[model samples]
Target: MPGKDAHNDTPRRVLDANFPDLALPAAVAARLPALVHCRRLASGRSLFVPGHRPTAFYAVAAGEIEARFTGLDGTVSVIEHVGAPRLFGLAAFAAGQPTEYEAVARGASEVLVIGREAYVLLMDEMPGFARALLAEFARRHDGTLRLLQAARHQSAAERFVLALAQLARERGRAAGDGWLEVTATQAELARLAHLSRQTANELLASAEAAGRVRRGRGHWLWRGDRE
Candidate 1:
């Protein structure tokens, strides 16, 4: 659904709600250009690795990046996906800790790299900037924790339904064919729902038979009807 893309910070709807006036001073946006350098990262490239220290936190200019962690058993779990104007390497900026995960460009992406030192400089000079940064980081941390908990607790069927409802509210459009153009594969749906591929397939099969979704080429289109 086109409505699925409805986000506070998505390129379509720009909001001044960014960096709260509570923490980010109005003038701090001016300092961004001086502290940040633009960079183009190609698809499949690794921006940083586990155990590496970051010099700067990146603000997405365009395109998306995937954050993943490799388990000791060699399983790779996609931890998070970030789109434009979102912050990456925020933990490093906050605590000077080595990165715990790997960051890879999901596609050709542009980012503004702002050195931690420069950020610290600005934070010292601008209390608003420091407050905003810390507050944002805390919120993201909480969101990630909640997502992980839901994945761990929710079943394949429940997760699928929850995901569909969210997508319906966010991206679903008013197409007349009793279908919405949700161009996600079963595999991708599995990842998003934090379920295994086979389990995800089973859930979708039941839903399809029950008229909850319809499969199209390289995509899974959700139908609003539920049995």
Candidate 2:
């Protein structure tokens, strides 16, 4: 569950920090203050569930959100983690369809919610904003394609390593003594890598033996050495 937070003024620095890749035009940026709302979500709380119609575009202001897909048998797989200063829910919102994945808070998080009407208005009125958003969509599409290719062609160990590398790049923080810590459980990492828990455990054991990664109680530590 998300609690409403009254946020009438959204600062430009905040937007700039959140969307470093997207350069919004002054016109679009100026209008965002009035068009956005803020919400706070506690850990393990859902921002939105599958099959829910999207009323707004969501961007992470702080903390992380996990995108998960639940099957008919009620099994859940984590699709990806969207950390602070990133956007999510763009696909469904842009297509005007119900979301297929559930967006859940990975920790206490702050999110910027832009209503669908405001988003459409910005797109219709600002060329620069529209182009920037479309480019972001293209970039994400390319990343997805690359992941799919790796899944189809790479060896299981190779895929696991790649997945860990990607997570380290996205979610890792310096933990001292040349180690980078990633905030994810082994089971979550397995799902993100599209591997079974047993296989991921085996691969991780091999890596640990090689002095590459160390598994913490609820996280992972990597030295960033890929060789």
Candidate 3:
């Protein structure tokens, strides 16, 4: 109940304007307004959890969603942050399997929920559009796999720095003077980097001393590598 919201008539144009990553073709985009339901979530509430069968995949219209995996040993791995306009839960839908991760709202958020039936209908009616969506899914899956591999191979400090850099690339705003501002708290960063909070803080302090970044109250100003 904490995360639930009543559906509203959100326009397709609004969805496109808010989430550019969706990038549905014109025809498919035009039809989505009628086929989807909208939901709003409060911070830290779950959208779905492991073993639950979801009939819909979600696109974050606003805010962030964290997909986390918990092992039997109780170690929780933050798999990804699904920021605005990004899609999640597609692999489960494709495989017709129960969800394997817990999807939780990172803060106040809005999501566009496309049901399996509507998704299947669209795919059947628009092969090209389906191909585009599939391609996007493949690309993201590859990226996630790479990140997981990096976590396995990298040291904690290395993982923290690399995770911060990647977060900056994806979500940070240009703060001028070669710095990017990312709105992530220490706990969140630690989770993302797969480190304990104290370990993450120590690494951040060292980085700050080296002039690599300036940690702010609730955000970070990082001097990222030039790309």
Deviation (Å) of 58 in candidate 3: 0.6
**Per-residue accuracy of model 1 over 1-227 as CA lDDT, tens digit each:** 22322321232111133453544344554454455566789998888989988877876767877787888998776666666667778897567789999988978987667786557666776666666777877877775675566778966677767555544533355656677766456775677667889988888788888877877787566776646
The digit string of per-residue lDDT tens for model 3 on 185-211 reads 899789888888999999999889988
Task: Give the winner by TM-score: 1 or 2.
Answer: 2
Candidate 2, position 78, lDDT:
64
- Order the numbered candidates by TM-score, best leading: 3, 2, 1
RMSD (Å) of each candidate, 1 decimal: 7.1, 4.0, 4.1
| Candidate 2 structure quality by residue, lDDT tens digits, 1-227 | 33332253443555566456656677766676777877899999999998898888888888999888788998776667888777789899888899988999988998889787668766777556677788878877676666666777988887787678768866889988888999777877788778999999999999999898988888889986644
Alpha-carbon runs more than 4 Å astray in model 1: 1-30, 125-127, 151-153, 158-185, 201-227
Better of 2 and 3 by TM-score: 3
Predictions in order: lDDT:
0.67, 0.78, 0.78
Name the better of 1 and 2 by lDDT: 2
Q: Which stretches of candidate 3 lie over 4 Å from their true place?
A: 1-30, 120-128
At residue 218, give the lDDT of candidate 2: 81
Query: By the lDDT metric, which is better: model 1 or model 3?
Result: 3
Q: Pick the candidate with the highest TM-score.
A: 3
